[model samples]
Target: MELLQLQYFLVVARLEHVTEAARSLHVTQSSLSKTIGRLEEDLGVPLFDRVGRKLRLNEYGNKFLHRAERALFELEQGKQELRDLSSPEQGTLELAVTAASALPHILREFRKKRPHVQFHVQMLATQEMVKLLHQGDVDVCLSSPAVEEEDIECQVVYNDPILVAVPKGHRLAERTSVSLTELKDESFIGVKRGYGTRDLADRICKSVGFEPKYVYEGDEPARLSALVEAEIGIAFIPSTARNSRDQIQYLQVENHELVREIALLWHKRRYISQTALEFREVVADYFKPLT
Candidate 1:
């Protein structure tokens, strides 16, 4: 019945491993187990089903978890609201993004306007960004993939075209544009499968009747450009990724609608502080002219 018990149970339910959950909670395994046992006794029902050393949430636990998560989320939002009310200008803004390509400009403008506001930024995968947004861990997310959750508000900040990048002396460097089919025999350097750009590139390639053959798969989008510069492989780079690097050529994809939409997302129900609201405004204004 205690708040600590609910917190511990939520962690255990998420990890499904008592030892790992106890470690994460910074408590002894026996203490965590005893607390869970007491919680079950007080509820008059077992919340978890024992599966070897792992704990799986039972039907009752599954039903309770949703409410438990909401309770914590509400408490956190209330805390943030109080902090905002007390010191509107000075607070931390938790932000997550898929990549850092568009961050410097946006953050620079935001910081210039709200110099007292601090920022905690995380470069997360598309799925991780969505997960944090749902958990109320992040105030906002800047991502390429459009989030379609009902509880979330997603606004398209920028629509950047995806360009095929090649080395300066490569055969395709002189071309202004080329079709996806033309690169069927070309090797590519791409972000891993879970990345938004990588997924888009894969889908577009599949639509053209051939899967892209990758010479390397990595998590860093910046490294993909470096690989292309080294003549290792060509890559699909976003327009935002364009910089002063002269070693590479970015060509448009011919007859293909290959574009990535950068979205600014926030939880609709979560309390938004003045600082967060200003940050959102800064982002909107930053992209206003681009649209």
Candidate 2:
């Protein structure tokens, strides 16, 4: 019923632990419980199902949470709009990306255009980026394996070529291009399963009639090049990731659609300020000539 109650409820629902949520909100556990209880009473239904010390959102809570989140998001947007009115040239743009290879170039371009504007950036997994965008936690997202949600607006920023990376002296290192089928039996170093690059590589490998056998599965895309250089495994490396590393050779994948389309995404319903719009333009322009 109260704004404070709604805020407390949202934290509890997200964490699913009363103690942790209370600690995060810097409130006493008993007080948080009382607030949630009052909210449930006001609504005439329990928002959560209790199982020992843990909590889970019930059907009614699930339905209400979406609306609750939207209400808070809109209110926060209104507050941001007011703040922007006072300081139009300076504001923090919250951004999320799946990879960091192309980020620096885009950010440098953006900063040149809007030196007064600041950025708060997070490198997240593809799925986590989607969740943050939907929750209105981040202003914009640069993602791969682009999202297809109904309320999300996704635009292709660039189609980065994915190549096979091999050690300097490997048999295929002398080649300019190689097919996925040729590397079918070779061990690979790959990004984790949920990653966009990994998904694309897996799909391509499967199309070639085999799944990539990864000897090293890592979270960092930058490290894959080193892993390949050590003869640990070959890997599918994006063109943006080829940051002047001399120990490895990058070969184009022959007769295959070995490209990852990086997309810029944002929620359609979330408010966009001038600062955010400028950054978006900077991003689009950064990739324009390359495409």
Candidate 3:
């Protein structure tokens, strides 16, 4: 019934190991177990099914977990509201981002405007960012291929063209633009499937009646320029990520509107603090010139 009990239960439910949960919670294993037992007694039902050292969340636990998360989120929001009322400009913004290339500029501008404000940023894939937003774990997100879910306010802040990057002397390098069909047989370098850019490229390539022949698949989009410079493979990179200093040639995708819509996303029902609002404004203004 206590808030602490719910907190402990949620951690245990997530980890599914009493010892691991206790260690993470920084509490004794016996104390954590006792608290969970008390919570089950109060609820008149067991939340987890015991199997050796691993504790699996039962059907009851699954149902209760959502309610527990909502209750805790509301309580935390109330506390944050009180804190914001005292000093509206000085607090942390919980932000998630899939559009990593645009973050440095946005954050630099944001810091200049609100030096007292702090940021806790998570670099996540598109689906991961969307999940965190729905869970209320992140106050806001800057993502690509804008989320289309209901109850989430997603606005396109920038439309960055996707370009094909090649080594300086490659056959396609001299060309101003190349079609996906032209590069159907060429080796490609790409990020992993979960990434928004990679997914977008796959969809676009498929539409053009070809699948990209990826010679190298990596998690870091930042490495694309370097990889292309090394002649490892050509890659589909966003315009914002292109650097003139890199020894690579960027080509436009001919006859295709291959642009990624960089978006700002937030849950419509979640509490929005003054700091979050200011950060949102900062993002909106940062992309104004680019738009």
Candidate 4:
């Protein structure tokens, strides 16, 4: 009926001698005899046949012995697994990140601190990251803000300044910084709608008092850089989107209020695992200066 009672019954069942079980169990023989009596009384069955001083298991007690042993073993194993999860030795940590946010520093530090954690990471857009988190496809995500939704928690990692990706021979390349108004006359290449880049592009155009005359729209960096090289148009992106060997050059926007905030996103229903929390602390410490 109770685990303690079952445990006492099991010890007596194994030894088949009340005195021997009591000695092994470190209890007085009278206390062990009384405990066995209580177990039998609670179960409404005589577990052992008492012949003189010897104890022998009845059929029901023999049948229940294996099941009781399995229950206790499983309980001990369950506790061990929980302890392993907290030990920082091994685990699967699933996460997603924005297509381009400079998180190499944080990732390097995380790997150094937790080498045993297997990381599953993907490059995704802000909206895509939100979708994955909601569907429970990932434990966490790094993203730029796009679609505002409920039940999704976001923490700002840092702000990345937007830089214009221009053709090397473009006239504005000589300028230290240029306003969005200066780009109204230039053909602007931009990311598609619903993406953070697209929103910022629209905001810049709006501030400069004219919408962009786009010649191309997509989310690929290499191809966009190639397009800029071919003299198609110029585009704006966060600094992380640069390709060092590309013919396109990144330019600063002076007196510009535009900035992209990189954030860590998670579902409200999901509890951050110990490894995830540790990595979060690492990122926070790494990016504190940028915030």
Question: TM-score of each candidate?
Answer: 0.87, 0.86, 0.86, 0.63
Q: Flag the better candidate by lDDT, 1 or 4.
A: 1
Candidate 2, which ten residues in sequence have the lowest lDDT sum?
Answer: 240-249
lDDT, model 4 = 0.76
* Winner by lDDT: 3
Q: Model 3, which residues run further than 4 Å from truth?
A: 13-17, 40-66
Which has the higher lDDT value, candidate number 1 or candidate number 3? 3
Instruction: State candidate 3's TM-score.
Output: 0.86
RMSD for each of the candidates: 2.6, 2.9, 2.7, 16.5
Please, what are the lDDT tens digits per residue for candidate 3 over residues 219-272?
A: 778988888999999999999999885578889998988999999999998888
How do all the candidates rank in terms of lDDT, highest first? 3, 1, 2, 4
Candidate 3: Cα lDDT at 171: 92
Question: Candidate 1: TM-score?
Answer: 0.87
The candidate 3 region of ten consecutive residues with least summed lDDT is 242-251
Clash count for candidate 4 is: 0
Candidate 1: tens digits of C-alpha lDDT, residues 34-60: 999999999999999998769999999
Those runs of model 4 whose alpha carbons end farther than 4 Å from true positions after fitting are: 1-87, 146-149, 222-230, 240-248
Task: List the global CA lDDT of all models.
Answer: 0.89, 0.88, 0.91, 0.76
Name the candidate that leads on TM-score. Answer: 1
Q: Which stretches of candidate 1 lie over 4 Å from their true place?
A: 15-21, 29-63
